[model samples]
Every structure is written in structure tokens, then in C-alpha cells.
Target: MSIGKKLANKTETVRGAAKKYLGRATGNTRLRTEGRLEQAKGNTKQAGAKAKDIFKR
Candidate 1:
């Protein structure tokens, strides 16, 4: 993937991790679930990008 897309995905993953930890510390199940979903979404996107790059070779 492009640099911008890679950065965006990484940011999302980092933000999600922060939110997840914050939610755990504050006992917020909703926030925790949202964080987990966000992380998964970011990871999936990154994986898809990698697959595309591999196929382009």
C-alpha cells in the first residue's frame, strides 16, 4: 500500500490499543469492544494491502 494508507492503518491500530487499555482501566465494556473492532478493522485493511502488493509482483 501507499505510505499514507500504511500510516493511517498504523495510526488506527495504535489508537485502538490506547482506547482498549483506557477502557480496561475504567471498566468500560462498550469502549473496549469498540477498540477491539477498530483494531481488527485496521489489521484487516493492512493485510488486504499486503495481499494486493504481493499479487502485483
Candidate 2:
């Protein structure tokens, strides 16, 4: 994956984790679910980018 994309994914993952933690602490199911979804989306994108790079080689 490109450096920019990798960095972006990592940042998103971190943000998601923080959001999830805050949601749990505050007992907000919606925020918790959204955070989990964001993290999953970031992970999926990162995986796709890595696969593309591997195929390009």
C-alpha cells in the first residue's frame, strides 16, 4: 500500500478505537457500533490496498 494510504488507515483505526472506548464508557450503543464499523472499514481498505500492491508485483 502507498505510504499515505497506510498512514490514513492507521490513523482511522486509532480514532475508531478511541471512539469505541468513549462510547463504551458513556454507554452509547450507536457510537460503539459506529466505531467498530469505522475500524472494520479501515482494515478492509488497508487489506485491499495491500492485495493490489502484491498483484502489481
Q: Where in model 2 is the C-alpha error above 4 Å?
A: none
Model 1 residue 52 distance off true place after TM-score fit, in angstroms = 0.6
The superposed Cα distance between candidate 1 and the true structure at residue 33, in angstroms, equals 0.7
Best by lDDT: 1
**Which residue pairs of candidate 2 clash?**
none
CA error at residue 47 for candidate 1, angstroms: 0.4
| RMSD, every candidate, angstroms | 0.7, 1.1
Each prediction's TM-score versus the true structure: 0.94, 0.86
> What is the C-alpha lDDT profile of model 2 across 1-52, one tens digit per residue?
6698899998888788888888999999999988998888888888888899
Model 2 residue 20 CA deviation in Å: 1.0
